[model samples]
Target: MIRLPSPAGRRQFGVAVAGVLAFLGQPVPLTAQGFCFHPGPIARCSWFSVTEAGVALSVPSDEDPNLTFQAGALANVGPRSAVGGVLVGAVFQNDVRLGVRARYRRWLTDRLTLDVAPGILLYNGTFTADSPGFTGELALGYADWLGMTAQLDVVPFEFGTET
Candidate 1:
């Protein structure tokens, strides 16, 4: 579970941030009124992932497929676009990797959404190598009952880079 700072600490931090913005002459979000990225209509305000489970496509290295799980926070940047980050971890019999990636989510339809994320991973196992490498993911989801998704996870260092 996520733990939040105390109310007094949060208020102090907010005051410090607003002071800094004022010193720099930057428009303060805390004091700004009716702020939106654009004058157009807005979409959902924000989102926090509960939990999602899906299969992962990884570089062939083990006898079993990878299962991945992700959780994170997101905020809408546009009518159909949301930006955020995720902490992704994969489990395989012979492989384990953890990745942190910035995500860009776009709504293709009212029910369909696509996520594109590129980041780095800490690869650990005999399937690839015990090294840090580039990671990319593409996911498609139907965000309704069951909240199902399919995702492809790629580690693009095994083919060329070696350690």
Candidate 2:
């Protein structure tokens, strides 16, 4: 059975879609002089949906199961490279954790790609000094119609953290 999103969820989805469209609508120059070997049939200026309203099930190292919602948009900057941003949110401990990341992707092969994202993570209801932290993610994915991604995220710096 297909379950529908709640009112709030729907609102978030709408805003995400609008944001992606607005980003894509901006004028940007496309050059074929970038990376990628053996350029495929796709055009150099083509835009790909890196992620669109994707939902993930996550279980932290010492936490309960959580649901994550993510949305992103990327344009092919080169034959084998793309750049974009992903917005993610999770409901944990009755609070919403939100983050926005700038992503850079390099396609090792037509089916495999590496993504690196660095951005800010905000937890709890308010964005206090301690609530915001530096976070980054490294992901490898077999990108296709139905793709699989393995990702790891880490908090590099925190107010009370030791290296």
Candidate 3:
């Protein structure tokens, strides 16, 4: 049986998620660029270019103490936002999770960006939520190449084991 985390843990998770969302939701300027090159005398710049398109991998944990690996693809939807889907699996357990998320990125400076993602968990292994509980993530991106993220997921209802 999969046991949920303690009440304190849950509260902490909620607070963290709320904070991240609030921070990201603040009014910020859109400063992302379409191209990363300089146009020559005869070249014209495209107004809209796909800024980022890549796969991301992470090992995220919660108060439950289970280490899980999450892999997903991210595509740029706006200047500072991305949307993607992720598959999460426990490293030492048999549970699998799937989710879809939308991320908002805020540039802190020239090389640092604060990222916030909010989404829904479609599947949570044996224990599935009835009302479609939510998930949130906060990340720090550096130099457009490296990132670190913390995630919180809540699945309130369970629907037994999956065969």
Candidate 4:
């Protein structure tokens, strides 16, 4: 049987949703709506460990926290749409998840953005089984990831968050 969140978990989720809604209601200047070359470092760490990791996901150990790096750029095709590409891999991983993907973004509000990228997994020279694999991301602001590599790999997509 499927279990739901505890009452406390539900309340926290509700509050978080409400906070996001409040942010969505506010507006920001859409000045930088062009080619945005954001190639930078992203660090990921997990506070908890899965004592019983399932088959879908694999990693070195508790020592190998989920992490990946991104080098990408997006140019707005219109007022609300954007297109780009990303390269993903090491520097952030104790292991590695390497891939490349095409990224797209849609401005929900001037301050809020949604990003989706789909790509191919080139290699993962570590615990995860390498194969005819895939990688991608679904994110808000493309920064604060709710489901990420270590924390968000619910699909055990071993999803590279940015690339």
Better of 2 and 4 by lDDT: 2
Clashing pairs in 4: 147-152, 148-152
| Per-residue C-alpha lDDT of model 4 across residues 105-139, encoded as one tens digit per residue | 66665556677877655554443432324566676
How many residue pairs clash in all the candidates, one count each?
Answer: 0, 0, 0, 2
Q: In order, what lDDT does every prediction score?
A: 0.52, 0.54, 0.49, 0.44
Candidate 2: clashing pairs of residues: none
| Residue 40 lDDT, candidate 3, scale 0-100 | 10
Would you list the rank order by lDDT, best first? 2, 1, 3, 4
Ranking by TM-score: 2, 1, 4, 3
Q: Which candidate is the best by lDDT?
A: 2
Q: Candidate 1 lDDT, tens digit per residue, 1-163?
A: 2223335434544554454334334222332233333211123333434245667544555557778776654445556765566666788875566655667778677567777876555443444433445566676767533344444444434455632
Higher-lDDT candidate of 3 and 4: 3
**Runs of candidate 1 exceeding 4 Å displacement:** 1-42, 57-62, 123-131, 144-163
Deviation in Å, model 4, residue 134 alpha carbon: 0.6
Candidate 4 or 3, higher TM-score:
4
Instruction: Give the higher-TM-score candidate: 2 or 3.
Output: 2
